[model samples]
Target chain A: MQAGKPILYSYFRSSCSWRVRIALALKSIDYEMVTVNLIKDGGQQFSEEFQALNPMKQVPALKIDGITIGQSLAIIEYLEETRPTPRLLPQDPKKRAHVRMISDLIASGIQPLQNLSVLKQVGQEKQLSWAQQVISSGFNALERILQSTAGKYCVGDEVSMADLCLVPQVANADRYKVDLTPYPTISRINKSLLTLEAFQVSHPCRQPDTPPELRA
Target chain B: MQAGKPILYSYFRSSCSWRVRIALALKSIDYEMVTVNLIKDGGQQFSEEFQALNPMKQVPALKIDGITIGQSLAIIEYLEETRPTPRLLPQDPKKRAHVRMISDLIASGIQPLQNLSVLKQVGQEKQLSWAQQVISSGFNALERILQSTAGKYCVGDEVSMADLCLVPQVANADRYKVDLTPYPTISRINKSLLTLEAFQVSHPCRQPDTPPELRA
Candidate 1:
């Protein structure tokens, strides 16, 4: 916990949490991580205390100097604005929109479909299949966009907000055993992103609170 | 389609389609809307012709001059960039983030759960229930944000991209029969948004390809 920084209520294995973590690290912002063991005892997200922090009952609810902000993408953007030294977004409007489009593609198009809560609703076998289908579908789109847009990172050579969004979701895709053979651009970007110390430190396995079963 | 504008492969009832329609209208950019009936002939989005436009086989694919762009959010941002008039996002970075947070709340957070395709995967009753649940959950979060942020629109009165995103999703929430009694702020903002000509022109009911069954 860094003094005067915000408080993040996050679960180690949560992709949403990982997104915020990567963003914070990329911006070199410091904050306290409050582990809300999401899978423990029927999910901590549903607990009354955590629920108060985020009515949506989701991971990665940030409380900064008494103001609580939910949603991973939102939180990252907030950080980007409040701390703009290592810019996560492009200064150019068109470029920013491109970054946002990629971010939304992952956040809306891919992540929700493979979310653990949604997957649990599908049967175990079907869940795996569903995860693969959604990931492949979303990654194929990402691959195409990357072919023209991806530089050293998702949008360009710079480590922008899009990279913050992509790395964790790509990690989730790997967890489901989805084959990336169809999306070489995405696979290459994923490989490139992993080398970043910011991304490396934010991996779920490295988080202090990640459960043993999910620490792949 | 405008003389030099893109060709949009859209379906009448797809929220994704509605999103792009509103963006085109907001930017005052003209485009040809080619109706690909999502439900007819086992969904036109899955047709080989549409597949050629979008390998992912999704509605709201755009043929810009020649290049194709899939995903509603991406397509909308592309238009905002390529057009760049009547700016869809706020100029201030923090305010823009706030706008996108709200947009994502609808675009990523709510729409996916209530989409026709996702609903089709589950049966009717479950579909209705999931639709209601996701809408209520999303709307509640939105209401809270609106209370803090709204002046005349979602992000401090200016008609930003957030309003464009919200109006259509709120329409879907109403279609799903999600009770709006609990979301007074969202209900109020939505009512305000409906008064806008841009929203009115893009409404699903007003579309030429809208099926009789879905019309109000």
Candidate 2:
């Protein structure tokens, strides 16, 4: 929406960042990627400079339309509002709510509980299991809800904002070794999403800053 | 927007439920509050019936406009979209993003990390202190962000969805023994918001399910 390309402060392996990356790509908006190393020296995101950019000290903060905004969904909604093409939200109010529901199920319900900050608090010994429990419970509910709402994507065949939230979170679940077989719908949807160029380019491993060993 | 009065499946002490309650009151949309206890008998929210209603087994699932929507912010957005009168979001795209940003900060950034499930996972001995850290860090960031945005409420004088989210979170911070004196902006905003009838009527203490001893 601004004259120059938007700048996204993101990390290579951050699911939240990947969510916004996919949204930007889906909208075909040009963006400059500014990597925030979340794992280096106890996180560059905590630095005073980045903190000034995002008082929350988190990534996927976008400098677009002359103001910086944090929270991936909020940024996505902003893009949808300011530059709405290949719309990510459905027109019907109820369908729009369903898409938002699926997104929130991942954003608020699952991701934060298993976030790196929370996992560090859980200690290395309990991190995987803690992530597993949160992800599985969320996926179980998502699968049940998606069964009623999904066609090909999370909300019908159209790729909506729900798909943007779903793919990155599914990647995080994979990283934590959460079993996906139980959630056939989620697993299937994720598999289909990965085949798309937008999601492919936005994959964590394909990022410029991804560790060589972790790169796909 | 629906023919009959909407039904909100909520709990007295649930911050998420309180968010929806405040939005409902602010919109002047009449709704029936159906209490779903989150603490009794190991949380009635985990019951088979309640789980069917909300697969996530969380409070603040609203049945309105002939469909049920979960997640407080999603519910509020739905209300804003379907009922445009007395708007909860500013019309400017950037300002709307700012309102959503504040709401997201409280919802995804703070609430989930300190949720009852997360607290239980932290263990009894660590729960309060853990909540304190999570909420304080969040509020500290929130205070900084609000300095530029807040006036009468979060995101200016309009009393947007951000205020609906903020008031309940401040209540939770008090419950966890977080000292609010450090966040003068948040404290001031919360104080001003409480003076409004919508926020007052929807307060946790004023809910029908509030215990006799807890009622104001």
Evaluated on the second chain alone, the candidates' TM-scores are 0.93, 0.97
Q: Write the per-residue lDDT of candidate 1 for residues A1-216, one digit (tens) a residue.
A: 224778888888888899899888877777889998777899988887777667677888887645677788878877877788798889876567668777877888889878877888766878888888888888877787777778877888888878888888888888889887888877788899898898888889988896678665
Give the candidate number with the greatest lDDT: 2
lDDT of 2 by residue, B1-216 (tens): 468889999999999999989888888898788999888899999999988888999989999878889999999999999988789999998889999999999999999998988888789999999999999999999999999998888897888999999999999999999999999999999999999999989999999999999999
Best by TM-score: 2
Residue B181 in candidate 1, Cα distance off native in Å: 2.1
List residue ranges in candidate 1 displaced over 4 A.
A1-3, A64-67, A90-98, A123-125, A212-216, B1-3, B63-68, B78-85, B212-216
Query: What docking tier does model 1 reach?
Result: acceptable
Which window of ten consecutive residues has the lowest lDDT sum in model 1 chain A? A1-10
Interface RMSD of each: 3.1, 0.6
